[model samples]
Target: MHEFSLVKSLLRQVNEIAEQHGATCVEEVKIEIGPLTGVEKILVQEAFELLSPDLPGSDCRLTIIEVPLQAICNSCGKSIVVQNFQFQCTACGSSNIRITSGDAFRLLDVTIDTELTTGVTEP
Candidate 1:
């Protein structure tokens, strides 16, 4: 499944981020996915479960946020949420519409655990 590749890429990104911050452990990774993204949530989860263990912080948790497909009606000049993948404008009943969001997979944020050090001075 394509989800495997996507999840692999995601883990790679997370690994890079964790390294950049000198994180001891990766705690969580959050992502936003929409219907238009053509990505199945369950498949992505499975892929992550299978592939994440090979990378650092194998215990990292993945959070998937579902967002609705949003678009702006060029005919009515109204912003609306597209339902049933219909490209027509609800208010004007026109086919002229511009998609605004919910079209791609987006990485929201990553949470990591880091080590903190404090220097002590002895007089």
Candidate 2:
């Protein structure tokens, strides 16, 4: 489903980055998951586990960073933040609003080490 496609894309990018630095193994993979992205954490983790084995990085660790939902009111133009999927104007009861943040999924950073012949390096 959605997880499959997203994971496929993520794996491709991860492998490319890992190969760029002559890295034979990736130690960590950090990704940002926005609230409006509508992605399940467990499903994403499962997909990564299932898909990453065949790639360049064998023992890669996947870390997900969840972002909260934030919106702005169209009437008063007030900024409002919510932990979950709640989008309503606090100052004015306006249903007409725009999402200022959240609704994106991106690979923020990756950790790979190729110089180590025995163990991975820390920086």
Candidate 3:
């Protein structure tokens, strides 16, 4: 599935960030996937779980946050919380709408463990 590719890319980026910070290991990875992005949660989770150990995210926990679609009705000028893929406006029953969010796949944050440095000189 394409989820594998996405996870691979995500891990690559995470590795880069961890390396830049002199991290010895990654603690956690937080990401948000919107409904419209078409990235299946189960597949992504599976991929991440299987691949995390081999990547820089060894012993890291992957958190996937599902984001709901938010849209605004163009005709009625009303905000709508879309559920069950319903694109129509509930207040005005209009199909003219613009999606404000929920169509994204983003890496929110990463926690890494850096080497413990001591200023004392070993004699």
lDDT of each: 0.87, 0.82, 0.88
By TM-score, rank the candidates, best first: 1, 3, 2
Best by TM-score: 1
How many clashing residue pairs, candidate 3?
Answer: 0
lDDT of 1 at 83: 95
> Stretches of candidate 3 above 4 Å error?
118-123
User: Could you estimate the TM-score for every candidate?
Assistant: 0.90, 0.79, 0.84
Tens-place lDDT per residue, model 2, 11-86, is 8998888888888788888998877887898999999999888666477789999877778888998887754455
TM-score of candidate 3 against the unseen true structure: 0.84
Clashing pairs in 3: none
| Least accurate 10 contiguous residues by lDDT in model 2 | 81-90
| Model 1 stretches with alpha carbons more than 4 Å out | 118-123
- Return the lDDT, model 2, position 15: 84
Query: In terms of lDDT, which candidate is strongest?
Result: 3
Residue 12, model 1, lDDT: 88
